[model samples]
Target chain A: MDTATTVLDLVGVFLNALLGGTVARRDRLDLFGFLVIGIASGLGGGLIRDVLLQHGPPAALTDPAYIPTALAGTGVAFLLDISPPDWSRAFKFLDAAALSVWASVGAQKTMGVGLGRLPAILLGTITAVGGGAIRDLLLQRVPAVLQDTRWYASVAVLVAAVEVLGIATGFPVAGTVAAITLGVLLRIVAEWRG
Target chain B: MDTATTVLDLVGVFLNALLGGTVARRDRLDLFGFLVIGIASGLGGGLIRDVLLQHGPPAALTDPAYIPTALAGTGVAFLLDISPPDWSRAFKFLDAAALSVWASVGAQKTMGVGLGRLPAILLGTITAVGGGAIRDLLLQRVPAVLQDTRWYASVAVLVAAVEVLGIATGFPVAGTVAAITLGVLLRIVAEWRG
Candidate 1:
């Protein structure tokens, strides 16, 4: 992965971990719960994608930066209560950004491994939504992505498709940028419409 | 990796898929739901273990037999009611047997890969209980093994430990047999007492 992608990937991990921590706080779970949920929310998607690729140990494990970044986000959430009044807008932005980065990175990674287009798109969508899905499952709820109203997963699928198209067309960098822009825009619009 | 282990592992997949199918049936899910649930229950554990090991594409995908076996189990449940009136005893037996075999095979596989005892034990427990945990999550329930009364996860932990010890002591075959026997006995006892 390039430096830009690496930075964005770590940012996604941090942001999602923070999001997971918010859920843990809402549930009144203890620190351990926050840690577990945070790690799952941050790293679960990439982990699933890498595993499916039959690649080496997941980047989440092999890369030193990922776990600590997730922990830092978790710590912030645990130590400070970013109440709903101050959270909604910022949360939405961060969530959307994370989704976009993950989708692009997932598709690119699959392509890097020489897999076909179908696997790339599938993995990209999975990489974007899987963490949240696992988090919801851990909390004993139907995944929000599976719900009719969330539209988060729809955005991921669209982002993945764009990334795949970009890579196929020999403009990987531009493709990632365009996909991310589209994802964030779509997610924000969906929330606004809701 | 051996023939006997391979046969038992596939058997475990089939049995767990049937268990997942039973859950889907109770939920009144359609055929697609059955296939989804069955595949998760049958293949989820091995997929998880393989992903964690970072060895190769999960055997569930690489080995064609795995998918078909899971489908067969789902097909049986979908085609026949196997109502609770006749399912309870058989269900318990099969569940216990599946658990025992997975626990043994998981630990052995980990050991074969030259990982330490802890990972082997952890993977073993995960392999034994992961499919059921995932199946429960998909049905929007807290995993049974995590509940106070299940004792299922506890059995898996014990089985894994035993396998680890056996492998360390160079008695892999005997260890697996002993672990399986112990797991089944303990599970049956737990159910009986309940």
Candidate 2:
């Protein structure tokens, strides 16, 4: 279970880093700026969640793999020639996937810590949308989750709600997976329709 | 000691919320936006600090008074006719005071948790600057702490350093108070010179 969670977490980090790097490139930020944005976007949500949950120095700060993974994602993003707008479809898919995984992970972690349903749900949403919000903020843009009418943060909220329900009713693992799948599909569908 | 700390904490929250509310108003955010920004700016630093230290739910969430204090600050900001730029001098003074208090409090909390020197200093700075950074991000501006050459974050760093040094050498309370005083003075001087 730990290994699976780790793998999913890395995938989410990589995708977020890519998004952050693309934003940096668009803004023509310095190399340091790119690194900062990439790392923050990749790990910012988890950091916020861990802090709110009273978890230790965030996993990103403690784990050896997280920073390198984020850096690799940023490097790939830097090397890529495709503009973010041109890769909107791919970005949307990756974003939704990452969001689903993060929301599930966050909800599970919060519940594991004995937090109540409301906190678990709130933390789940924060974990899903935090990195992107940080990325936009660094770039001096309003967070998409705040402004976009499409089901961005809403999808995470839904996933979190399902996770809490599943936990309360038993069958946590099954519920998490179902919620993730449902969230990704909803986000993609919303984006496509919009 | 607890009473003193609580007073300082409330003052810090009120000032930061005022700053957040002003930013929200300038950006033409609705009432909800005003509340969100106000609460985030007032509590963001402490939230980041407690998380890093593995502390329980942040005081802002646990203590009933904290939220209301922040709300009052926002309400006062909303009612005021003075624009942020127009009140720059007062804002600078209040910002400096808040920064000093938060940095000192963060360092003290880190030390109390038995964290080492480096983490104490780092968390201290985060506690001081995190709120303002969040405010800037929400307002779609580069964090002033990151971009401004001013002694803003630097002063916090210095205060944190002093705090750690004081703890390592003994005399924690005196060190914290001295650091706060020094940090506030340095910030005011820098603003005046700038």
Candidate 3:
């Protein structure tokens, strides 16, 4: 877990829980459905990553952070009843945040396991996007990446770039800053242009 | 990987694919979603069993039989434009078939791995129901288990009982016949009462 990505992942999952829960609520789902989405949206990515790595359950199951956070997020969404427009905005933020977090996490984990830079970058990309892909499949929807979403895949690349540069230069802070900056900027650019 | 459960686990996956895919089509899903449901329905129980056992992705990813059968089932449903009612009847049959499959698979896997019979039976029950539980969650519907609907869980227990009895008595064919008879009967009873 790259430090920045770790932080972002924590934040991203929390946000995902809220956003996914809100979406479930809008769909008029019952409590179990809401919690299911909240938990899934929050941890689905990591679970997919772990399963792929043959690691089993991953941090989502191993650590306690996600489940309770997601449960709380679901409760909040049910209580507050976020409107569609607001939910949409939250969704965009979540997408951007998750993209960057996944990218960095992917790269970091790949490198952590001693893979080469390129593979690390690629793994990072998959790690970041894996959860959403699983989520969409679960919901019976076309995955967002498969759809024409603006620069979705690019964020993952940018995540790798930061780490690749940092690894080359031996400046961990520089890599983190650069990667987060690139992801946030590109995401904002996509949104602003949209 | 339980020797006991392995008997029809492979066939169970294929049959459940047909069961799940038909249900998805009956629910009016498009092709891709239908395929997803088919795979989920077939693999869901086993996957759940594996995850709980910490042996994940289950046979869902590793087994050669599973993926193709699921795809074929979904393809057949789409090609035939299987009517909703006919699909529902298939669902009823599948419910019975899947339960038998899961019960044996679950008990064997759990017992093979050195777990107590109680846990094995429990795991088998979850294995039989877990996939449907997941599917319903994805569809934003209440899991039939959560409600007092039909003898869904009962079928799992019956299968487990047959398994337990066979293991106790050294009666292989008798055990299987007992399981099949119990599973099929419970399913028919559920349908008849409905």
Candidate 4:
């Protein structure tokens, strides 16, 4: 939980919430809709993280940072009166960004929780995708990860690879940095071309 | 868990899905919407169960029974297509039924997880409320639990109390029977009176 990581997680949650609320707002949702998408995306990662770790609720109810972070994000969306076409492109960027950070953070978090390297790698990937998956499912939309053909699974796979490689080679910092960069860059490139 | 408790839990989920989807269709939400509500109410309890257990994705994912059961219920709803009414009344009953069942099942399951009576009670209440809370939040409606004062919390409280007392007194069968009957009767009475 480095300051950088903590900030990243918070930012990740906040940004994800902002984008999720804004985009989902295009639908027929109302005030509570905004809150739902916000919290689902913001706390979704850690909630999945906790579930994978067998810790349950994943600090959602207990963690004040998450709820307020989501709340603030949703507020931004409501003020903006978002629609689908407005941020489709921006959403892609946000998705890319969330994927990158989540990959790295999720992996390291797995390690911190005392999971073996393999489980940690898997957990990291789950943490990254699980939130969005749940959100989409709740919205009654098919999950992007399951539908996309652009190797969406690779982002998670590569992150896990980096985690395993980092641990095995004792270049944890370097491995993580490379892994994060790969994720961010890949996601960005996908979004750019997409 | 005792055989009867388990049976009731499963049946409650199946029944709620039927009831919920029927209500959804009456609202003109289409197949997808009905499915959403059906699955949401059905998995609502287990989602909370998994979250509390830190098992993540709920047992619904692991157990093949959950979705199929819900889908079957959804089909029934489609076929039955309960007559339309004011959205408000249907919603109230949906919330009430789900809450009652969840309160009972959540408490029983929490105790089964080996948690203390207090956590079990709290978890049960949360479990009962959690799914609908999430569902309504996503739908942009104020959650009934947060908005109403009638017996939302009371039902959960009563269910948890029955489960705990049954466990403590070594009279679990009687306890569970009382819990279910009490929840249903109370909900019916509350709805009728109000």
Candidate 5:
């Protein structure tokens, strides 16, 4: 992957892990639970994307950097005293950032693998939301993707579509940045309006 | 794989789906929820195993028979008038059966793929309990695998270890049958005693 893409993905992982850790804390989970949820949230979406593409063992399992990055996010959550209600707005913004970057990267990777547009977009959306869905599941809550009327998953889909279109038209870098910006903005707007 | 293994896996899928459907019904979810939970419960374990193993697209998505079988299980749950109290005992029994079969089959598959014994046993347990965990998560309940004091996951781990040992010692068929029986008995006994 290009350095830009890699940077974006790492940022996404950290943000997602933060989101997971916060949720775990909210549920009164212990340290192990925080770590588990953090790692799963950070890497879960990418793992699902790779698996669907029949790529080798997920990068999360093979790469050494992933676990530590996730753990760092978890550590932040454990050390911070921010309550869920207090941080809810900031958390939404962070979640949207992670969602946008993951969607862009996931769709780009899928397209690079020569998958059809439909699967690429679908998988991209899956990649963006899969981690949080898993976090919610582990916390014994209905997944926000499935329950919320807000355009959470839709924003990811839109980002993926933009990424795919950019690749198809030979403007991949511009397309990715544009998609991420659009997705994050849409999510923030939706949350704000709601 | 072999016909015997295939049949056992199918049975596992059906029973897991039934368990998932019951949970969905209990949660008063709509039709989409029932199907989503049913499919996840039936195929979740296998999907997790396959992804970890880097096996191709999970059999649930590739094999036509899987979705139909899962759907059938959901249909039964939706149509049946069985009360939760009435089905509780029966559900436990069926869950044990599925656990036994899935554990055995998963361990065998992992070994066939040349994974080491430790991973084989762990993946086997994951295969047995993953679906139920997913079902519980979707239903907004803590997964029994993580919380229950019962020997639910422990039984599957034992079965997997036995299967791996059987393969190593050249008694595959007998070992599989014996492990399945032992697992089922352990689970049933645990439930009964509780």
Candidate 6:
């Protein structure tokens, strides 16, 4: 379970970093700016979650793979042109998957720390959306989650709520799976319909 | 000493909240916006620092006085018209004092937790400038500390460094006093010259 969690965490970081890198590229930012935005996008949510959890240094800082994965995502974005429509389709799916994983994991971690259900839900939502929010803030723009027509932040909130409910019903594993599945489906459907 | 620190912390929160409320007023934000900016400006830095410290929940959360103090500041700003030059002058001095207190206190708290000097300095600087940075982000503007022509972040860094040096020299009390004094003087002078 720990290993699976770690893998999912890294996957979320990488995809989010790529998304952030795309924004940096659009803004025509320099290498330094790419690194800053990419890292923040990849790790900012987890960092905020861990900090609020009163856990040790954020996993992004303490874990060896996180930073390198973020950098690798940035490198991929910097080196390759991913502006094609096909790439966008792929990115949307990947981003949805990442958000699902982060939201569930954030809720699980918060629950593990013995916090109440409300904080768990709040932190879970934050962990899913915080990176993109930070990235947007760095660009001096309103975060998409705050104004997105698609079910972005809403998907995260629902996923967190599902996870919290699952835990309450003593079906942690099933809850995670269900939450992720629901989140991915909702997000993709929202995007497609929009 | 504890009582003094608490007093200083509350004072900083009130002043920073007022500062944030002033900005919200200028932006013609609603009451909700004023409260959001005010609480964020007052407590955001300390919250960030505490989270990084891996301490228990942030003092701002655990302490009863903080949120009310912040709200009070916001209320004052909402009620009064303090757009005159005289009020601005008084605000400048109070703001300077608050900055100094927060910077030194942040460094001191970091050191008290048995962390190294570098973290101490980093956290200290964050604690001083983080609130305004967050307020700006919420407003979708670039943070002043990041781009201010005035030596705002620089002053925080210097104050933190001074605190770190004082601790290293086994003069913690003297360090806090000197750091605050230097910070206040430098900030006032910078504002005056500007």
TM-score of model 1 (CA atoms): 0.60
Give the least accurate 10-residue stretch of model 2 chain B, judged by summed lDDT. B81-90
lDDT of each: 0.85, 0.82, 0.69, 0.70, 0.81, 0.84
> Candidate 4, residues A160-189: lDDT per residue as tens digits?
678668867899888878887788788777
What is the DockQ score of candidate 6, to 2 decimals?
Answer: 0.19
RMSD of each: 6.4, 6.4, 8.0, 8.4, 6.5, 6.3
Candidate 5: pairs in clash: none
Candidate 1 clashes between residue pairs 3 or more apart in a chain or in different chains: none
User: Model 4 segments beyond 4 Å from truth?
Assistant: A82-95, A149-153, B1-43, B46-50, B53-194
Tens-digit lDDT string for candidate 6 (B1-194): 37887897788999888878888888777665676678789989998898778779677755668778888888888788555244676677777778877888889899899999999999999999999898888888878987868888889999999999999999988988899889889988998898
Q: Alpha-carbon error at A8 in model 1, in Å?
A: 1.7
Pairs in steric clash, model 4: A56-B54
TM-score of chain B of each: 0.94, 0.92, 0.80, 0.78, 0.91, 0.95
- TM-score of model 2 vs. true structure: 0.63
lDDT of 6 by residue, A1-194 (tens): 38887897788999888878888989999999999999999999998888888767787888899999999998887877665254667678778888999999999988887776766776788899889888988897866664445668788889999999999999999999999999989988998898
Clashing pairs in 3: A45-A131, A102-A128, A106-A124, A107-A124
Candidate 2, residue B16: how far the Cα is off, in Å: 7.7
Tens-digit per-residue lDDT, B1-194, candidate 1 = 78877887888888888878888999999999999999999999888888788876789999989999999988998988775457677677877878888998888887777666766776787798788878888787866653436578778878999989998999988888899899999999998897
Could you tell me the TM-score of candidate 6? 0.62
Write the residue-wise lDDT of candidate 5 on B108-147 in tens digits.
Answer: 8899889889999999999999988877766677789886
Worst 10 residues of 6 chain B by lDDT: B81-90
TM-score of each: 0.60, 0.63, 0.60, 0.59, 0.61, 0.62
Better of 3 and 6 by lDDT: 6
iRMS (Å) per candidate? 4.3, 3.3, 6.7, 7.3, 3.8, 4.4
- What is the DockQ of the complex in model 3? 0.11
List the candidate 3 regions with Cα displacement exceeding 4 Å. A2-7, A87-98, B1-41, B47-194
